[model samples]
Target: MGLDAFVYCRCWQDGLTPPAPVGPVGFDEEGYLSLVVSGGGYTETDAAFDGWTASACPHELMEQASEHLSNWTGHRLFQQALGAAGWSHFPALQAELPSANGGRMPAEAAVRVLDELDYFEQQAVIDDEVVLVDEATEAVALRYVAAYEGVLMLGPGYRAGVDPEGFFILDPDSDPPATLFRSARFRQRVLPSGQVQFSDEKKSVQIAMSPVGDKGTPPEWLRLEKQHQAPAEFGYIVEPLRRLCRAAVATGNPVMWC
Candidate 1:
C-alpha cells in the first residue's frame, strides 16, 4: 500500500528545505506517487524551514496534496485496486424501514445494480452464510462507501452472499450472518415482509478479506487514536491526545474529523 519512491521538499517549487517522507508513497492504478506528510510538522512552506522562527505547517495541505496526486496519475489505480479486491460499491443489505427522506427507490432499480455486478464476481457461503467475492471488491467497496455514503460492519453470525446479481451483499438476516451493510441507497428495498431476492446467472464460492489483518495489538499510542471513542474519554487525556494528533499529522493522516 506504500509507495516505492520519495520526493523532496526542495523540489516543492518553493525555496525551502523539504520535510522527510513521513510515510511510504503508495501507487494508485495509474502509477501516480503519493505519500503522507506531517501537515503540522515543519515543511518547505514553514518560514525558515524549521529554524527558531519557522511557522508550523497546516494539516490541510496534506489533504490537498493527496487530492492532487489522485489527479496527477490520471489513472484510477485506487479505484481499480478496490475493484480488484472485490469490494462493494455500497453495502448490499438493509433492515426493513420507511424511507425517511420520502423518496421511493424502486426495487427494480436496486435489482439492476445487482445484475450489473453478477458478471464480475462469485458468491459463496462462508460460515454458513452467503456472500460475494471478486477482483473488484476493494475498489467496489471504497467507491461504494464514498458514493453511497455507507459504513463497514463487523461481528459474528453475519451471512455473506451474492446479492441476487453476481455482486456481493452481506445479508444480516441469515442465520450466522457475519456483517450487514446499511445504507440510505438500499433503504427503499427494505420491505415490510423483509423478503429480498434478486436473480443471478451464476453463483460460486467466495472468500472474504478483512483490512484489519490477523495480528498483534498495536501500541497503546496507536490504539488510542485508532479507537478514539472506544474507551469514551479519549480527548480528556492531554498528553495522549497531543501525541496521537502529532502522530497522525506526522504520518500524513491527521485525525481531522476526530
Candidate 2:
C-alpha cells in the first residue's frame, strides 16, 4: 500500500504546554490541522518544531512547491550559467570560499561572491536534497509542469512550429511575454506501451515522432495547450502551498516529509 501524507501547524503560548496530539493528520473543513491517519501515525516532536509557533508541510506538497519556486527562479538555468561562468562545482566553491580567506581575492569581493553563490546553492537545495522527492513527487511535478506549461500556450504570440527534423519547438522569441521557454526545451517520446518519457536532450534522446503531417507535437505541448486557458487556477493552488513552505522555514520550522 502507498503511504499517505499530511501537513500540520502548531502554536503554543508561554507557560502553556504544547498542544497534545489530537485528531489524525489532515486538513479539516474548519481549517484546523489534524493527524488522524486511517492506520494511525505519530507526529514528530523535534526541538526544531517546539518553537512558540510553527507549521509543518507534507512531503508531496513541499516538493510541488519547490518545483514552482525552481521554475520561477530558473534555478537549473542559473546553475548552468554558474558553470559557464567558470564555477566548476558550485557546492565545492561555496565551501572552499569561506575557508580560503588568505587568497588573493579581497575579503569583501569574496563575501559578495559567496552571497550570490549561497543564493543559488540554497535554491538548488531548497531546504533539502531534491533526491528525497521520490517517484510520487516526480509524478506530481510532471503533471504540474505539464499543466503549467499548457496554460502558458494560450498567451498571444505563442506559435507552435515544427523543427525541420519534426521535433516540436515553442519559440519564445515569437511570444514576447513567454517565460515558458524552458518548458519548450523538454522533448517527449511515446514508448510502445503508450507511456510518455520526457527529456531535455535534443541530440542524445532519440525522437520517435514520424516525419509525417504536423511533425508530431509532443503530448506535453498538447497538455500545455489544454491548460493554457486556466493558468490562474493552477497558480492559485501551487503558489499558496509554496508560500506555506516559505512561511514554515521563515518561522524556523523544519519541514518533515514521510
Candidate 3:
C-alpha cells in the first residue's frame, strides 16, 4: 500500500508534555501524539501551513496523492537514495531517517537532515513539474510524482548475486521480490518466504553494476539500487518531502505516516 505521511506534535493538542520527537523510538499502541488532531484521524490539515496537503482532502490532486506522489514529494527511489547516503550510521544506531513509508521523523530532525539532503536536493531531486519521458516507461519521474503516496520498512539485508558477465539481469526468484529500505531502527518480524532484503550500503551495493544501462526495463531491485549508484535521479523524491519537512518545521510538528 502507499504511505500517508503527516506531522504529529504529541502533547501539542493534549495537556501532556512533548517528549524528544527525534531519535530511536519503538512502536506503540498510543503513538507519540495520542490525541492530537494531526494524528492521522482528523481529516482537516492544521491551517497553519500551505505546503502540506492532507491526503484525505476533497481535492483531486490529494485523491490522487492518497495512492500516489508528485513532483513535490519523496517516493521510493528518493527514500532509497536517502538510505544510501545515511548508510555510514547503520547497524549500531539507525539514522534518524525513516527509509520506508511507516514511522515518523520529528519535524526538527527531518529538516535538520537538510544538511544530508542538501547535496541530494541540489544534485538528485526531480523538478516536481517536468522531468522527462523514458521511452520504456513513458515517464520515469512523471508517474512517480503522480504516486505522492507510497512505504514499509526492510530490516537488515544482503548483497545480490549477479551473472557471469556481472550484469544485473533479473532473477525471477530473488530479484523480483527484493527491494531496499533505511530506517531509524530495524524491526523484528518474520519475512514471508521468497523475498530478499538487506542493508550495508557500503559493503553490499553494486556500486559499479551498470554505470549507464540503469535504464531500460530493469526490475524493482535493480532500479532502486541503480538510484543508489547514481546521483542525478535522487531528486524525484526530495522535492515534495523536503518541502513538507520544511513545512513541518515551520509548524513545529512531528511528521507521521498513516
- Residue-by-residue lDDT tens digits, candidate 2, 168-202: 32434543443222333354556776433545543
lDDT of 3 by residue, 8-50 (tens): 4322233333332332222245344222334354333433222
Tell me, by TM-score, which candidate is best: 3
lDDT of each: 0.27, 0.31, 0.37
Please give the lDDT score at residue 60 for candidate 3: 32
Best by lDDT: 3
Q: Which is the better candidate, 1 or 3, if ranked by lDDT?
A: 3
Each model's number of backbone clashes? 35, 11, 24
- Sort every candidate by TM-score, greatest first: 3, 2, 1
Instruction: Provide the TM-score for each candidate, comma-separated.
Output: 0.19, 0.24, 0.37
Looking at candidate 1, what is the lDDT of residue 16?
38
Backbone-clash count (model 1): 35
RMSD of each: 21.2, 17.2, 15.2
Residue-level lDDT for 8 in candidate 1: 17
